[model samples]
Target chain A: MPSLDKTVAEPMIVFDGVEKRFGDNVVLSELSFTVAPGEHVCLIGPSGSGKTTILRLLMTLEKCDGGTISVAGQSLSHMTHNGRRVPADEKHVRDVRKRIGMVFQQFNLFPNMTVRGNLIEAPTRVLGMSKDEANARATELLDLVGLGDRIDSHPTQLSGGQQQRVAIARALAMRPDVLLLDEVTSALDPELVAGVLKLLRDIGSSTDITFLCVTHEMGFARDFSDRVMMFDGGRVIEDAAPEKLFTAPEHERTQAFLHAVVDR
Target chain B: MDNLGTFLSVLSQGLPFTIIATVGGILLTIVLSFVAGLALLSSSKTVRVISRIYVEGLRGTSEVVQLFWIFFALPVLVGFQIVPIWAGILVLGLNHGAYGAEIVRGAVQSVPRAQVEGAIALNLTPGQRMRRVVLPQAVVEMMPPFNNLFIQLLKSTSLLSFVSINEITRQAQQVLVPRFNPQAFEIFLLLLVMYLILSLVITAIMRTLERVAAARVGRRPSARSRRQATGAGVA
Candidate 1:
């Protein structure tokens, strides 16, 4: 909630020609994008289109082989040292990463901790919040997520929808300025996806947190996102407001992609 | 009655030595297991190679041969000699410590990749992720294998008899009972019973440890254990 930087006009996230590869297979090639502060942006495309790789790079789970990524005006991949820009060190990456939080498709909750324990873990350990303060904040977040009554239960005890909800609460506990969501409901049962998406919709409407989401849920993209970018084979073919992009896409690839997706 | 008294008294003389070797080996094996286990997963290539050498070297050789070398040749090489009992303890620790290290390595790796990613996503430091996330789960996975190693180490204690250490097996071997003829079968039977009891005790202890560890990661206690815990409270 504190001022993220000296200038409020800067975009919350900027990817300038970022490239990533695994051996001979290229994942993202010269990927360029940006999200304005408090804007909710969604990337939609077929599987293996490099949408999720974009989220992973922003999360610092994978490094880009070329170009730079910046969050809240602080460069994630490189930093200026003594007036010369160089690759960021571990400490530099971690310092910049403190502002970002990610939720995976798998709902990767720590089995070793209960719902309350999961929520309090980062707030107390990384932020140095006292036990009492963390517990109180955890209670607040649980209430926000509509799981206040089940704080003492372990993750395995919860349904997939409930578990993903707790995963969302855990990410929010960090008070992250940028939240990267990677197909958060993809692993849920078909019956459970609607509940998780509705929760996300509520959070998106209520908060000013910058969101960069990679999801296959075209409905959520159309209803909730400020802008939707269509990706194909690691490149964005079209980037436009959700209404325009979904209803009247200009590119042939975008039109065909939507046709295939919507028909299914 | 008189012969029975003599048999019990002679065997009891070596009982303390047998217990000391087994217990000492267990403690030593535990420490080395963690050290080598963690070193196997260390980031530095040198650390991993050094741990591999210790693990593979001990596992590849025969236990008795290793024990004899440590007790006999090691002294000549190092220009000093340890008492045979201490040497027995050291050899047992090193031998089983190898298997224990592999068990540890497997458990640590078995922790899901997603669990680690969740920790990193939370921005917890590397040490925190291992301690608060990976190890608590891995320790539960280690209990069963460690139980097996502890029993094997207990049986290995009988090897100490070769170094002139007075223990159960040595006493049975040296016993003649010439006036009453050989009681070798009787002594051997008694030895089997005694070791069975020891193995069961070790198994029970490990079971309790496994249950406690599983509970830490949120396993529901079974009704049987819950009743036993309550009964223990009452008693």
Candidate 2:
């Protein structure tokens, strides 16, 4: 495992007073957090508590209704190109987004592409890596994910666990600084969950890249997370280190959620 | 003998018109379909409403009515005269586009939203998502409906003759009415054969495209191919 404790001078991501609402419903309210470089934070929440929204906003897939987001010392939701603090444009968003990668619950592999193609696509197209270089990286990632033998297989041909692993490899092929996992193993069959979790655990142990994972797996959170946040009603009700938050949560909602999730 | 020559010459003349209308209509339809389909999925409500109205107005009217509007009313309304053949081509293209629009919209929408989110997770922009992920899958699903629309467009080209566009049906009528030939049935049968052959060619081409798309997506081979590959499954 790499040393996550090797602290950097600047934080990697900052969400300052973020607010998001949908019509009459509030998905996130005044949510503020900062992830230092190499920190692994797990967002544990009940459904519709805006854990996934946090990831979406970071990816700029969803726009925040209020507040500023900064990634790598740059304002993401706003821009300051050439020393002028102006609203960010499409190009600026694209530039910021390139440094982040996300994994979905459904695996969401491109059905038109083979496993190797999925792994190589973004690195070649978005990152400007050559085909040969992308291919070599893809092969390396596939081996890491334990899908080296299934490199030529299509998404549908692989089991759910294998497909999610391919998706993880595809995300990693971009060499992102921030990786978001939105319940990556939730869609898999129970028998398939262990393999995916093991792969994630291995990556968590080995990489210094910041991780923001949304999950219900208490065991994985306890083992993998440096800090675990329990969210309820679009607010972080409990935020603490894994041992304190999981075993001695401060709020009733957190206690109820942990009881419900951990038992099964 | 003279009657036979007249039939052959007139039929040959009209054959070109039929080919032109059908092929030209298809090209126009694909363009319009893509435009209208994108409109339906537009983020703006006004754009969506406008697109819906255009599709409804065009698709609800009959082809004959559309032809009349384009050939007769369009000249009056706009104070410009278009050639009859051009009018036929324009009307057929615009009309077929409405139906093709529905196919494009349906196929694009049928793709699960999760697939789109996945693309977003990779930080792809809207344009990249459409080009790389959405459109490729939508195009494969779009083909089946497009095949039906194409056949309908082919048959509808016959209506062009009502506006003096000189398609095969009109030419055959011209020959039989003037010659008063006893072989009317035979001439019509030949016309039917020509249409059948054209439609069959189109169908064969569509099947080839479908096969290519399926193979690109890594769909399983047909039972025949499977059997051949496995040496008749050790029976």
Candidate 3:
């Protein structure tokens, strides 16, 4: 895990006073957070507490209703070149988005593709890598995720845990500067969750890609995260070292929520 | 004897048109349906709303009325006349396209949002995502429904008689109306057989396609122990 000094080396993502709403309901209100390069930041909260929304905003799946988001020292919510704001164009968005990869709660493996195909697709398409190069990288990723034998298999042929691992491999194949994981193990059967978590843990240890994870896997978060942000009502209620937040939380909501999750 | 000879000649002459219209209209319907269905999902508000209205309006009305409107009324409305056959085919295509649009949209949308988001996460552009991920799944799910619609469109082409296009039904009507021949029943029966055979052929093709597509997605066609096929061997 990265320490404060290592984090101070450079900020990879910056969210400044981000505000998002759905009609009258505000999902994210004046949210400010940052993830330094090589840091793993875990976001935890109740179901509707905007943990997923934060990741979505970074992915450009959802736009912020207010504030600016910068990734790799460039604006995410808009296009900027040399500190001048411009209308976000497709090319610009694609360029920015190319640097980020996300793994969804629902392992959205391409049903039409083999596991190998899923991993190679982005590399061949977005990264402009040769087919041979992409395939080789896909093999490496599948092997890394412990599914080398399943590379030729379609997603439906694999178990849920296997599919999620493939999804992570597919994300990693992009070699993204940052990775967003949204409830990566939420949809797995209870028995299968550990395998997927272990794969993510392996990824966290092996790569320097900054990870922003939204999850209820408190155990994994506490072990793998450099920092943990506890959110409620779309605002951060607690932000501190995972050990401090888990053992000696300062807020009632954080303490109660952690008890509800961890004590179970 | 003389009437019988003329009837055969007329029916023969008109047979091609009937086959052509139905075949052409059905093809057009498939294309239109896929396009309009995708149009409804456009990120632009104008495109989505326009496609929605077009689909709703077309699906709501009778096919015959739409045929007449496009073929007969459209010339006056647009101040330029189209050939009757062209109008009939076009109208059939539009009407079917509207219905098809819904099937396409529903099938595509039925593909879980998770899959789409997955594609997005992979840095796929919208077009690549649809072509590579979403459409393949949607097209698989849409096969049965689309096959049903195609068969319906085939039968619906009989309505072309109203616009003076000589299709199978029209030829039959023309043959029987003047002579009052008892063989009308027999001839109509033959037409029914032809339709039945056509529908059966269509069903077979669809089944084959379904098998091929499902196999692509790693589905065993049936649970009964049959020899498992290896890879898609040249559809």
Estimate TM-scores for all models. Answer: 0.92, 0.86, 0.87
A44-130 per-residue lDDT for model 2 (tens digits): 988999999999899877899998888876778788768788899988888888879999898899998899888887888788899
Ranking according to TM-score, highest score first = 1, 3, 2
> How would you encode candidate 1's per-residue C-alpha lDDT over B1-235 as one tens digit per residue?
4466666777788889989999999999999998899899999999999999999999999899998899879989999999888898999999988878887898899899889989988999989999999999898777777877888888889988888998877876766344445666666777777777878888788778879888878775446543333111100
Candidate 1 clashing pairs, residues 3+ apart or interchain = none
| Runs in model 1 lying further than 4 Å from the true structure | A1-6, B1-5, B176-181, B220-235
Could you give the candidate ranking by DockQ, starting with the highest?
A: 1, 3, 2
What tens-digit string does per-residue lDDT give for candidate 1 at A1-264?
236465477888999999999999998999888899889999999899999999888888887899889987889978889999888897888888898899899989988899999999999999999999999999998898889999999888999999999999999999898899999989999999998899889998898889989998999999989999999999999999999999899999999999998999
Interface CA RMSD of each prediction in angstroms: 1.1, 1.6, 1.1
What is the Å distance of residue B96 in model 3 from its true position?
1.4
1 versus 2: better TM-score goes to? 1
Tell me candidate 2's fraction of native contacts, as a decimal between 0 and 1: 0.59
Top-TM-score candidate index: 1
What number of backbone clashes does candidate 1 have, counting pairs of residues 3 or more apart or in separate chains? Answer: 0
Candidate 3 CAPRI assessment class: medium
User: How much lDDT does candidate 3 score?
Assistant: 0.83
Candidate 2, residues B1-235: lDDT per residue as tens digits? 4466666677888999999999998889899999998898888999999989988999888889999888888899899999888788788889988888888998888888878888877767788888888888777676656766777788889899788888998988775655656778777877887787777776666656767876676663355432222111100
Regions of model 3 farther than 4 Å from truth: A1-9, A81-84, B1-15, B49-62, B65-85, B219-235
Q: lDDT per residue, candidate 3, B1-235, as tens digits?
A: 4455655566667778877887788889998998899999899999999999999898888778888788768888899989887887888789888888988998889988878788877778889989988888877777776677777777777899888888877877875655657677666666676667767777677668877887787774543212222111110
**Docking class for candidate 2:** acceptable
For candidate 1, give the lDDT of residue B196: 77
Runs in model 2 lying further than 4 Å from the true structure: A1-7, A81-84, B1-13, B39-57, B60-62, B65-87, B177-197, B219-235
